[model samples]
Target chain A: MYGPSIDRLITALRVMPGIGAKSAQRIALQLLERNRDGAAELAASLIDAVDKVGNCSSCRTLCEGERCTICSDSRRSAQQLCIVETPADLFAIEQAGGYSGHYFVLMGHLSPIDGIGPEEIGLPILEAKLASGEVDELILATNLTVEGETTAHYISSRARAAGVAVSRIAHGVPLGGELEYIDSNTLSLAMQSRKVI
Target chain B: MYGPSIDRLITALRVMPGIGAKSAQRIALQLLERNRDGAAELAASLIDAVDKVGNCSSCRTLCEGERCTICSDSRRSAQQLCIVETPADLFAIEQAGGYSGHYFVLMGHLSPIDGIGPEEIGLPILEAKLASGEVDELILATNLTVEGETTAHYISSRARAAGVAVSRIAHGVPLGGELEYIDSNTLSLAMQSRKVI
Candidate 1:
């Protein structure tokens, strides 16, 4: 019902995660609420973000430059490396706090049937980062999903072949999660992962 | 963690309708992706829209100028007025097409808990518009929600003594909706709205 420019902007925004028709309408209304300048600014920012913050050539984390801040920081422990499937996963871990080591962003998980392989998802870059012999411990912090597990297994083999210690993050009931709402799989995992104090 | 200014932008965008934590992060990232220009443009547009678009003095529809375009245009049917809850609703009606009449935007519904009353929400202005003698009929197009119905009844009773013909939009099955999937209330409405051959 709006002009094509407005429609295109709505369509472009809808491509993002969780946005549906009603939500898209709200966004379009918001842009209109801001008027021409607001619409233009949002449009410009979206295009700019799409072009600018890409995978770092080194650790593969998102960066504005060729090298991410983690890769650029010389004081960060090169001997400790945390590996993740995507930049988003790295961001999630960073938000959880106390991660001082460098990171290797795989850019994706290994979904072989979907044609997403180790080579396709920055695994080559990860291998090179490991091959430098600077990393003593490579932490496999991928998601608990099947794809994430497969990615971890692949990376663990690669890292261990290079004689580096590999460790997986604990998988169990999430913090503050109630037992009543917990699924069978997670409940079992929690029982299996029980620690002796 | 980044600068508080960036954090503020993320918080500000998070309050936006339909934007989730991830989308808010994406919006914030885009702001950084475009640097100062993006922030400046966003801020400028936000301030401008807030400052510029206000209710038309005559009719309550949103306007960038002293009066809305529909109010200013002599060609529009002043005798027929459509009432809606928000400027966003006006856009929705406009997109539905074929209704070329003036509009009154209530901006908010009759929420007693919110302490909203007639004078506070531009009902006096609506009464004046209706009493101007140029208007022939008043269209009650407020939403079907409880608050919307209350507001519609309030507006209807106010204009009843003035001899204005008021009618609601057809209550029936929404276009493209399956009868089996629709609620009983909607199905009943569809039955009641049956037409002659």
Candidate 2:
């Protein structure tokens, strides 16, 4: 039970994911008591990001300007496009490295129950890109969940119709995965998708 | 990863308590994609709180003005003063309710190894308040650790010299506490400090 400004700050802080009442209160107290200047700077940065950042027009990835960094980089292969569900997934791929290709972020997967269908995930833009004959191979790097599989299958059909080859990211044991710790489904997939050594 | 603005936003968010790199990135993405308006409002609120909020001149509690609401309220009992180590503890006491006395926040406790001494906890301010003859009883509500005990002992001696009666908050089993689950030290204290009905 602090003053009005403190109450307002706690309320505002709760908007961030994973922050609850106690956490919001603790963070608010710390900001007010210890790091006022740093808090002010963080606030300014948040506002600046909100005002300046938007979805990249070319690939739907987040960017400060019209085109995202990956989309603007000419070194990335236009013929190899990676499809993903969200911006976080796109960033995760980038962090892993070695994938020097363009990305077409769906922004979300095809979830019909949530009223998110093909158009909702920006399928028209992807189809247009495919029809332009720029992308020869589409890499479906969506998550391995049921929804992701369904979305990937739908996009694959669309890519086939547009005369583009499509490939899904492999599903099996992770690089450091142990068979004992791996889930039964993953172990089965690893067994079923065995490759010639 | 994302864009320059997004990167900056993530870095700024990590300054908040408990947020790590992955959580910061996730929150940044969510803000840009889902709640841009809310993010903007939070930013504005953070700036407003940082620019306006300061310590109460009388009691060292956080406030938006010269005095905190509790210190400014005229109805509270000036004869009974509660001494606390931090504003968080004061707030905790208020949340528990029933206490309606003036407060003198230490802002910290005596930790010599950490370079904190009696002066660091504003002993002079507390001594001045006691000598003013406004306070008849001084309640020590510091934590239960070794530092809290040392601080309380130091303050008790000063308060005795100033002709003010001193009392400490009780250390016993918490309400709704199971006797079997209580720590041995707490059980011993409860046994040693048994009260008459």
Candidate 3:
């Protein structure tokens, strides 16, 4: 370590996901050695983000203002609401295109063992939105993992009780994925959900 | 992107060595979604480093004050000067736990094509330190690439003129590297530099 400030920067960098000791050191040194001005700008940006960005008042996705971009955009379909586990998943869905519906980010999936219940993942906000009668359909776009499935099921039941149609995103072979490499469960699901050409 | 602050943070994160668009987005979203306090602390640390850390007056390595810890330490051998390309390389050598000598970081190698000449890499400072007669042995620990070799040769000639003995670190099979997986040039060097075991 060069000094206390450099060491502190390295230590602070480890709070980021996937950054270990070696990576933290490399980043710290790179920031210090290459572009001090860029480093200062990055620091300012980080602080600004930490201060300004927060949960969207409407859909719970990250936003600088009261509503997220998707929630505020008049072009996006409010009747078909897509529920995702995280903002990263929402970004992935947006990048894929073709989905013009607004999204409600759960921030995390339910984990009963860890005491993360329906309320913990912002299920109440979703239920209240569903009950408002504005959204006609709820598209559960949570991940394929066990926790994601449980969360999807819980939300589906709530939507159904509120007279809103519920649909889970398909689970099968990924696009361009070879059949041989596909897992048995996914192959089975793909077979069960075979559609007309 | 959620907002201007979020986008700015992502752009700033892209300045990091290997972070790309997706990685920057992931990092920004993670920072916004959770651990805002940690992100704020990282920002503070980065600004502190940018404001305080500078080149050591004697060795040109990163430091908070005039001289770095290594240059100020009286216990380390002043007669043996190990020249390296960067502080990261210096850290690697220190972690290896064998050499206990002073170091002079060039910060970069000499590349006339890129307009980075001897003076650009602080050769004048190095020459002045060598001419002082404090150092008897000059250890060239630059990398094994073409530029590194060229820089080492140039430094060796200068050190020789100043009556300081010059030596390049041995190039061969790495300590934990398997011969089969290593490059052909390294294999050739390993064979050429084979010593009595």
Clashes, model 3: 0
Each candidate: RMSD to true structure?
6.1, 1.9, 1.8
Docking quality level of the chain pair in candidate 2: high
lDDT of 1 by residue, B1-197 (tens): 43334344455555456676777876665445334454554444444455455557877665667787778888788889899887778888888889998888887788888888887668888888778777888998888998998998988888887778888887888899988899998898789889999
Candidate 2, residues A57-126, lDDT tens digits: the string is 9999888888988898988899999999998898888989999999999988889899999999999999
Residue A32's lDDT in candidate 2? 83
lDDT of 1 by residue, A51-151 (tens): 55555777866566678777888878878899887666777887898988998877668998999887877878777877888889999899899999998
| lDDT of candidate 2 at residue A153, scale 0 to 100 | 96
Evaluate all candidate structures by whole-model CA lDDT and list the values in order: 0.73, 0.90, 0.90
Model 3: residues >4 Å from true position, as ranges? B176-181
Instruction: State how far residue A4 of model 3 sits from its true place (Å).
Output: 1.3
Q: Residue pairs in steric clash, candidate 2? A: none
TM-score of chain B of each: 0.88, 0.92, 0.95
Name the best candidate (by DockQ). 3
TM-score of each: 0.68, 0.94, 0.95
The digit string of per-residue lDDT tens for model 3 on A124-185 reads: 88888887889998999999989988889888988999999999888889989999999899
Chain A TM-scores, per candidate, are: 0.89, 0.95, 0.92
TM-score of candidate 2 against the unseen true structure: 0.94
